[model samples]
Target chain A: MTSLLNALPGAVSQGLIWGIMAIGVYITFRVLDIADLTVDGSLATGGATCIMLIRAGLNPWVALLIAFAVGMIAGFVTGILHTKCGIPAILAGILTQLSLYSINLRIMESKANQPVSVDKYPLLVSSRHVGGFTLKNPIFLMIIIAIVLITVLYWFFGTEKGCSIRATGANSNMARAQGINTNSNKILGLMLSNGLVAVSGALLAQYQGSADVNMGRGAIVIGLAAVIIGEVIFGKIFKQFWLTLLAVVIGAVIYYVVLQLVLMMGLNTNDLKMLTAVIVAIFLAIPFWKNKIAGKRLGKKEASKDA
Target chain B: MLELINVNKTFNVGTANEKKALDNLSLTLNDEDFVTVIGGNGAGKSTMLNAIAGTFRIDSGSIILDGMNITSLPEHKRAAFLGRVFQDPQMGTAPSMMIEENMALAARRGQRRGLSWGISEAERTQYYELLKSFDLGLEDRMTTKVGILSGGQRQALTLLMATIKKPKFLLLDEHTAALDPKTAAKVLALSEEIVTREKLTTLMITHNMKDAIRYGNRLVMMDEGRIVLDISGEAKKKLTVAELLAKFSEASGHDETSDKMLLS
Candidate 1:
């Protein structure tokens, strides 16, 4: 219990950082209704791009901007594959993710891992500043970033163009009938989502003090876990768009807090992926199960009333 | 106001399932003409509507709307001039959106969609007034999602959306076929009232013979992807279901065996 309590702050920090990535996932998975796998690679791409740019003696903020641009390019490829070439979205994302593997390695200069020491370079957020009350603390920085992102997204989705995108996600047939260019909106959504994912990767690289080729492995799963967790716990109350995004961030925090407890219970680190898959699978099925039960109850009530 | 010249569309072009959905079909609508379309299954009535709406590119033909060649225009591009309602109640509006938001989207049809707010306070009042005109009590549920609405309410809303922007032409592909008979009648009456009030050009397809006979300034009967019979004004007003059946048999040179059109 003491050990878990001691690690709580660290868990919260990691959760907040990853929460940004989950919000990106929410854009594709919930908003655009696409299960994009590009995050698995673009996240590492962001990390690699940022780390390499800093290694080349560039401003950290500038490196982050470049990382975002590169991630958008990756998303553009997937969008073209899906819209222009008529490939299925899932397959398009997989192709981009596979190609980004080589790109990430090249960005890492053929190295499997690269480190950016906090002492050598000034970073936006770092684990070294985890317990501090200063501005460099990852928790505070991530919260601010999350709030900014939610605000921007809320305002954007309320705009005419953003509503068109939402309409595209809701029903493409209706979107076209309403004169919305659904294909273009879909591509735009993918770009925006991947850009944010990359930004999250940049933050994660800084926090972990390294950019590893494998850092983003199974990242999409974690994102889905966070989004699902958020919706399951807070979806009932948070019906508004911005509130839902906040809920997803909070869901990430809860997920990490639970994960830390599980780790403290002497679980092997190597089995973490399997556990994550199990958790996400169960959460995904919960809504379906609830609906089925509710439907049966309704049917029984009607039958009894008729009798 | 709209012209479809010899439009041809074939589904599954060379496969065993190949079917010529539209076969050199040509149609023209004058200003403010309300034309009711009637056809049996596979007569290409919906296909003709789709061809005009640019749901798919025609194999060989030109569609001219207000002197603009729109045969090559994509579906969304052509939507600027067209208002469409589908047979499915759920197809014409986004179910997850609020009632007013759906109305706002329709109000901006064919206009440039920039960063402007999706739904404004003024638009809300206008939408409430428009929805109130339907008399379905939808004005009070402006913020409610369309998914919770009944079929009748959705169809009514769809009708409103189709004409909110005052499109060049309205295409309704059996829009009320999915509703209960009473609701269908209500929707049909509302459609008639709106069409008359707006003085808009319209092409409505229906499986119901009574509706085909009772409404519209003109009637078009399609058979085997072509217009076999066209009646207008006094001729359409005096036509009966049995006489129409007789005309159909005479036009097609065969005894009508299928009850699909006549039964409805």
Candidate 2:
């Protein structure tokens, strides 16, 4: 119990960082109605770009910006493959992700892992300050970043171009009939989504003091977990767009906290992936099960009325 | 003005199930023509409208609209000059979007979309007044999602969306075929009101013989991917369902009319 309590701050900080990645997933999965698997590789791309740039004597902030741009390029490639080449969205994402594995390796100079020591480099946030009382605390920085991101997203979604993207997701036929270029809108959405995921990855690398090529493994599952957990808990309360995004962030925090508890209870780290998969599967099936039960009740009512 | 010259389309070409949907079909619509098209199943009525709308590229044709050659224009590009309503009520509007938002989308059909707010305060007031005029009480629920609306309400909203920007051409592909009798009648009346008021050059496809004879200044009949009968002016106004059937039979060399056509 003491160990778990002591780990809370680090867990929360990690959760907030991952929460940013979850927001990226939400844009593609919920808003764009696409299951984009590119995050698994794009996340690493962001971390690799940021770390490589920082090591090359660039400002950390500038590195983050460059990382975001590179992530967008990765997303653009996937978009072209899907929209221009007529590949299925899921397949397109997978192809980009598969290729990015080699690209990330090349970015790291064939290294499996690269360390960005906090003592040597000026990182924006770090786990070393997780329990710090000052503004340098990772939690504080992540909270501020989350707030800014949510505000910007809220404003953007109300714009004409944003509404067109939403319309494209809702009904492509109607969008085309209304003179919206659905293909371009989709490409824009994918780019925006991957850009955010990369930003999250950059932050994660800085916080952990290292960028491992495997850091983003199963990232899509984690992102989906965060999005689903947020919806399940705050779906009713967070009807507003900004609030919904906040829920996703909070969901990540809760996910990490719960994961900390599980680890403290003596669970093997290797089994964590299986546990996450089961939990996500159950949550995904919940709506279908609820509908089936409701349908059965309606059938019984109809039978009674006929009698 | 709209013109389709020597348009042709074939589905599943080279396969055993190959079918020619449009075959060297040609059509010309003068300014404010308001032509209604009728034909039996598999007759190229909807295909002709779709070809004009650029839903799919015609195998070979030259489409001229408003003095511009648009044969190679994409669907979204062509949509700038066209307003289309589908037979399925669900196909015409984004079900998850708010009523006002849907209208806002249609209002900027041909314009470049940017970072500006999607629905302006002034536009909201205008939309409110327009919705109030529909008598469907939609003004009170502008923020409601279109998904929860009844089929009739959706059709009405779709009609408003189609003409919200005063499109150069309005294409109705049996838009009211899915509605109930009373709602269908109401939508038909609304269509007439909007068309006459806007003076929109229009092509409307219908399965009902009565509706084909009743509405529009011009009437056209198609069979086997070809326009077999064309009537206009006083002749079209005086035409009856029986006369239409006789002409259809005579033109197509078929003694029997499909039950679906006759019953409707």
Candidate 3:
């Protein structure tokens, strides 16, 4: 109990960082209505690019920005494959993810793992300051970043072009009939989403003091878990856009806290992936099951009325 | 003004299911001309409207609108001058969007969308008044999602959306077919009011012969992917459903066997 209590802050800070990536996933999965698989690759690409640029003696913030741009480029390729080449969106994301594996390895100079020592380089956030009350505390910085991101996104989505994007996702036929260029809006959405994921990746690499090629494996599942958890817990109360985003971050913190409890319960580290998949599958099925049950109940009532 | 010259469209080409949907069809509409099109199933009625709306690339054709060649224009590009309402009420509006937001989208149709606020206070007030005019009690539910509305309400809203921007041309593909008899009559009346008030150039397709003979300045009958009968001026004004059926049979050179056409 003492050790778990001590590890709580670490889990919270890590959760906040992952929450940023979850928000990026939310953009595609909820807003754009696309199950994009690019995050699994783009997350690694962000970390690799940031670590390499910092090692090459660039400013850490500048490196993060460049990482975001690279992520956008990857999203752009997926968008082109889906829209211009007429490939299905899921296939397009898979193809980009497959190609990104080699690209990520190349970016790390053919190494599977690379480290950016906190002792040698300045970083936006570090696990070394996990429980600190100082300005270097990642939890505080991440909270600030999350709030700013939510505010910016809220304002953007209220704009005309942003509304057009929403309309496209809601109904592309109506969007086109109302003169919206749905293809362009879709591309723009993918780029924005991946850019945020990259920003989260850059922060994660800095926090961990390393970037590994396989660091982002199954990242999409984690992001989906965060989004689904958030909605299940907070969807009823948080009708406003910004509040909904905040709930997603809160869900990530809760997920990490639960995972820590599971580890303390003596679950094998090798089984964590299977556990995550199982939990996510259960969460995803809740809504479907509820709907089905309600439908059956309604049918029974109607049958009784007819009788 | 609109013109379609030698428009042709074939679906499922080079396959066992090959079907020629539109066959060398041509049409012309002058300023403020409301033309109601009637035809049996697979008579190229809807296909003609789709061609004019740029729903798909015609196999080979030229479409001219307001003195501009728009044959190659994409659907979104052509939407600048066209307002369309489909047979299904769900097809014309974004169901998840708020009623006011949907109106705002239609209000800015063909205009450059930017970083500006989506719905202005002034626009909201104007939309409220306009919606109130329908007397459907929709003005108070500006923020309600269109998904929750009834089919009749949606069709009425769609009619308003089609004319919200004063489109150069309006296309109605059985816009009220899904509604109940009373609601359909209400929507048809509303359609006639809007068309007359705006003097809009329109091409409306209908399964109802009486509706085709009642509304619009001109009437066109299609069969076998071709315009078999066209009546206008005095000839169209004095025409009844019986005369239309008789003329259809004579002009089409075949007996009227489809009861769906006569009954509708």
Best by DockQ: 1
Model 3 segments more than 4 A misplaced: B259-263
What does candidate 2's lDDT look like per residue over A56-136, in tens digits? Answer: 889999999999999999999999999999999999999999999999999999998999988888999999998778988
Off by over 4 Å in 1: A293-307, B260-263
Name the TM-score of candidate 2.
Answer: 0.97
Model 1 C-alpha lDDT per residue in residues B111-176, reported as the tens digit of each score:
999998999999998888878877899999999999999988988898899899998898999998
Q: Candidate 1 at A294: error in angstroms?
A: 4.6
Question: How does each model score on lDDT?
Answer: 0.90, 0.92, 0.90
Top candidate (lDDT)? 2
Count of clashes in candidate 2: 0
lDDT of 2 at B243: 85
CAPRI quality level assigned to candidate 3 from its DockQ score: high
DockQ of each: 0.88, 0.87, 0.86
Q: Which pairs of residues collide in model 3? A: none
Docking class of 2: high
